[model samples]
Target: MAETAAQFPEVQGGGSLIVAWQVKGKTVLVVGGGEVAAGRILHCLNADALVTVVSPAARLNPEVAYRVAQGQVAHVDRNFEPSDLDGADMVLVAVDDPAASTAIWQLCKARRIPANIADVPPECDFYFGSVHRDGPLQIMVSTNGKGPRLASMIRKFIAKQLPSDAGRAIETVGQLRVRLRQIAPRPEEGPKRMAWMSKVSEAYPWDEMCGLSEEDIGNLLRFYPSGKVPALDELKAMRANPGADKEAFDGSFGFSVGA
Candidate 1:
């Protein structure tokens, strides 16, 4: 017997837990070759996931074709087979035929596979949100499959507001973390280290850190104690003169003045 919607009291409204999946080097099966499928395939490729597209008369867009020629994507020019989900980590169905999509969804459910049917939220195990990627940062905005267009607009707005030097800053902070561990190896300093890194991430000078050597970094860390962050005034001054000589003052500032 099929259970009615009222029987499931836990899920009365539309809400999905947004999460970032680590799909790198994992196989993702896309069960269509239309524009929607192509878009999903491109997203998977960007995440470094292995992608396979299945469609009987799959129509490839220009971008999809380029990737295909580059050997980044594998295309099985045939109808979707249940066996296709043999080793798939996730599945995306974008076929135009509603009946075919339903069938695929049912099979995926039986197999306990994560699946997303284009424009069909109720049948989806996950929703593909609008994604914006910086160098090492990725931001995703989801409307719970309600307003995709709105989600895309929000993504554009956020991308424009984000700093272009974010990726560089991330790398600098990464190096700083390694050096900090050397300075403060005690387990007690772990929380302090994280707090200090949080401050650095918020107000970092991406440009100044470009030419700094490892030794130069060590000089800056002397002022920051293992369990304390730099004073606000000191941070402010460094933010005011980002291009000043690093050796001019005590090695207490490496952040940007206008970050």
Candidate 2:
């Protein structure tokens, strides 16, 4: 029988390019100090971006004021100014005055800078999505500015379905990868290293992988040169008896013979 080809429906619109942007050490300018602006500032700070808010000191909400007071963000203590865009890699406008916000957006467009204007979808170069963050994992849901509340609801729903240790499992895998790199330090060994890592990942289930410790990784590294994947029982035994002789185990790494 001939295989059937898969068909997919055409998308209605070209959605925004979803990406994990690395904004560490980049300049992000925020043109407001109200509640909305406060949220933007927090998000920028979380990304390790250098954030500066251009709003009058009196206009700053309590949250914004607290951040400014703690020296977490720089405050311009005045309304938006054209010069404020200098050295800014990204801009976020959240001022209450629609006219001023529009002017700021225009300046950003003229300078070819990326900007997000609050409550003005047409003028925005980007839109903020509702984000759910774990240690090193982040899930974002966006509605393309059509229905933000619905997007947020969806985000919450997704978060509840994820395992609590999902982030820790990712972190454990990262540690194993780093150890593997140290073992295979030559560029020519990349393919073999990747193959071994893939085998190890497949051999262990999520819960087992999450429970792996630094000692377990060391034991796994022993089989790297031979490209052998250790069974779960072999791993447990190795943990139980750190000084056990490897030669005592069968070549199948604790797996029984074909029976």
Candidate 3:
């Protein structure tokens, strides 16, 4: 057999989980019906995926059971067959049977389906990761099929180091995107406006910056190519002075002309 070495980076257990695939809105087939299967489904849904699980094994986690009952999942009560992977976007096999998992792996490969075997890393295309959540913000940690328990432990440590309001800040920024676009400036001016907005956000509390009604927030500032920037023009005029030595002061000074 040919030997190969693959590079799998250490997971931080806090941030920096790299994705092999983005399965959002894609079909995923999970083979097994137990707590492990439930966990796999939970993470899949967290990415906003469409999931289907093979049934007839055992009870699932209560959360997964509830999601199934709520019509958020589809169940196929049966055993593994290559046909089961037909049209599947991805396949996850969490059965305790290593042989079964390996078989599913081969079948998936033959069908060109992306496969993950929870217990058999050699057969998996991707692995489930330890996950950390701070509200809407999630950090996924994967050791590329090693030390999941250690990953969880590391996640706890990293979670403590993160700012509590990170998720809220992300949400606020996401909410601000449309408004920013609607008031778009000239292409070259966009970066300057973004810099100013970022400074304003950092100077103010998240709640205060994000708390205004959408309309009121929209009206707070608008950027345009024809925008009257008297203060900016004044600064530019000052910079035009013969002995200003502008480049020496540009980096350190927060204020700038045409910035």
Candidate 4:
């Protein structure tokens, strides 16, 4: 299935490239209170973007309403105005009325602001794809606005296959990299650092290191070349001990393996 997706890129619709945006401390204008608008608000909030929702609808999603109460979001209880796009970094128009959506789209265009209109792909500057997040790790799957279900399925499948402690392990590896750079004997040690990183990539016991503190990680790195990082095969053998329980270990790491 993966090979087929790679061989037939034309089947996926084109027009936009998938890229992650850095939205922290930015402002986002959302022009509706419907479910779609609420979903967008959640995504923006997760990215640490300051969101302002302009809508006259009776109510919005409970999560959004709660945020408004907590001062994490600003809710303007009225219809959207052109001026709502005044200082917006981006816009989302998710009103049910087509005419309203079109109007908002035009306003966004006039202001040269990137916008997305739910239910109208042609008006979208970008499409939100399926995502799976684990701690600091996030994986996004997209079909270029062609097949949302396919993207969702791929996201779920990959979510299950990821190691429960993968996020923590990646952070630990990052710290190791920083340490290596600081202590490199020569400035031309790029290749040597790369080789060490490659070797340790599959050699660490991810599950065991899930609860390791910063000090523990630092100590481990100090003995890197002294066989501190165990081989994957060796870790597997250790996990096969009679007292070892895979399900319990996975649960401790917050992974839903059975899903």
Please report, in order, the local distance difference test score of every candidate based on alpha carbons.
0.75, 0.83, 0.66, 0.75
Candidate 4 lDDT, 53-135, residue by residue in tens: 99763767776677677888898989988878889999988888899899899888888999999989889888999988776
Worst 10 residues of 2 by lDDT: 250-259
- lDDT leader: 2
Q: What range of 10 consecutive residues in model 3 has the weakest lDDT sum?
A: 249-258
Each model's number of backbone clashes? 2, 0, 0, 0
Off by over 4 Å in 2: 1-14, 206-208, 241-259
Which segments of model 1 are wrong by more than 4 Å? 1-14, 56-58, 183-216, 224-259
lDDT tens digits, residue span 1-259, model 1: 3567558766556567788888999999998877898899989989899999887544776766777778898888788989999999889999888998999999999989899999887789888889998677788999876789999999988776655455555676678888889888899988888887777655544544444445546655765685444543354354435446544333433333222
Q: List the residue pairs that clash in candidate 3.
A: none
For all the candidates, what are their Cα RMSDs to the real structure? 8.0, 7.1, 11.4, 5.9
State model 2's lDDT: 0.83
Weakest ten-residue segment in model 4 by summed lDDT = 233-242
Q: Residue-wise lDDT of candidate 3 within 51-101, one digit each (tens)?
A: 998867345657667777888888776776777787799998888897778
Across 110-179, the per-residue lDDT of candidate 2 in tens digits comes to: 9998999999889887789999888888888998878899999999887776655557768888998899
CA shift at 46, candidate 2, in angstroms? 1.0
Supply candidate 2's per-residue lDDT for 130: 96
Model 4 regions lying over 4 Å from their true place: 1-16, 182-191, 202-216, 223-259
